[model samples]
Target: MTIIRTIPENEAVGEVAEIYADDVESLGYVPTHTKAMAMNPAAYGAFQALIRSVAKPLGLRRYELVTLAAARGTRSQHCRLAHGAKSLKLFDEEQLERIARDYTGAGLTDAEVEMMRFAEQVGRDAATMTEADSQRLRDAGFTDQEIVDIAIAASARVYYGSALQALAVDVDTPPTLGEPLRAALVDGL
Candidate 1:
């Protein structure tokens, strides 16, 4: 249960309803985060746009990877589950589980591992970064723009994940989202 109310997709009104409609169009169901963000659709949309902008440079898969790592670093149950389920599109249960358990041994590519580390570092302590950190990303084959995108995605998790966890926002029911994925998300949570 959550202190914050999670407005249902059908019950949403005004701009929030519009966003919920769009979410259903894209994802087949409104996500928990979307329901929570419905408190202010304009700001929520802006944040989504920012995430999209970040993903444009980093790509969706990389963005999801960063999100998973950032969420795990922050111990955001909703995020870990949501992102773990999303990553299922690119990775298998074994892979996602391995990643959730330990990214270093998850058999990810060096580049992906580096990005994961970057996300964790960004979520844990961005203030501790130095030029060498950027250089490491460069060595991992990421352009400066891509690195910035990684930072943005991870930072977004820090912001949104913190709020969601602090408010104890409850995730949506699994029925509409179907099997396996629902199981994955809930179990991962």
Candidate 2:
């Protein structure tokens, strides 16, 4: 269990209850991360809005890929497992396994690889990034807007992932994730 004391689901009301309801409807259970964030429902709502805004223009596949890269860079096992399972909607098992193992050799397009690398770098070290980094994304065929979106997606992940880590939230392994891919993300091999 997390060190934080969250609103218990049974006693939840108002925004917290609503948040729990939405998760229960979509995910079939309330995620531990959701419960942790719901300690401050308004802040949690704002965070969700930020994620939706970033995801809306980028599309699900791109967001998940960028998120996975960011999670990997930060070594956030929770985000990695969660997003890795979400990525299964877009990629086959073999391809996802390959991406988890090594995305460079996973047969992704050059543009895709560049964006993931950029997202990883953002999570790993944003301060060290220079204009040349943005230029690399541009060279990879991304527009300024797309590059900005990728950065936001990656940076936002650091915020969320850091919160989970700080609270020592338990990693929720989605059942949809296969063993090999799970092992790769969780075990880092």
Candidate 3:
């Protein structure tokens, strides 16, 4: 059960409602994490901005891969469900299963796999990352700017992951999220 009651879509008002409205129109639904974050307007705004900034440059598919790896590493049910749902729409069922099972085994290109690995390391322990980690990403062809963006994405996941876990948020199993992906999100939770 959720520690705090999430504001339902219909019940939201003012800025929260506006945000939800936009999300619904764009993504076909307001994700549960977004609703939970609406508990604090400033945090919700920051979350939205961070999502846009990190995701827009890479586009949605790669962003979802990075997010899935981060969510898995963080063991954040909320992000797992939410991003898993989005990922389903971007990748085929087989590819989604691969990402959910083990992104490295998912036939990701060498560079993309490296990116996901970097995301996992940063999500699990940002402080432990050393020059070797940076060098590995650099060797994989990720530019300095892309590496910084990946770090920013991982930082955003950490912030949101902690919030979702602290809130004891229930994972939402949207119909569009699909059974396999849903199972993956709730795995070991």
Query: Best candidate, lDDT-wise?
Result: 2
Q: Which residue pairs clash within candidate 1?
A: none
> After superposition, which runs of candidate 2 have C-alpha atoms over 4 Å from their true positions?
none
Residues 69-164 of candidate 1 have per-residue lDDT tens digits of 888667676777767666768887777776777788889999999998888888778889888887888999998789888888999998898888
Each model's lDDT: 0.78, 0.88, 0.79
Clashes of each: 0, 0, 0
Query: Would you list the rank order by TM-score, best first?
Result: 2, 3, 1
TM-score of each: 0.85, 0.95, 0.90
Which one wins by TM-score: 1 or 3?
A: 3
List the RMSD of every prediction in angstroms: 2.9, 1.3, 2.0
Worst 10 residues of 1 by lDDT: 173-182
Winner of 1 and 2 under TM-score: 2
Q: After superposition, how far is residue 19 of candidate 2 from its true place, in Å?
A: 1.3
lDDT of 3 by residue, 18-101 (tens): 889987887788777678888898878887788899788877877887787777778887777777766767888777777787
TM-score of 2: 0.95
Q: At residue 34, what lDDT does model 1 achieve?
A: 77
Off by over 4 Å in 1: 6-8, 172-189
**lDDT (Cα) of model 1:** 0.78
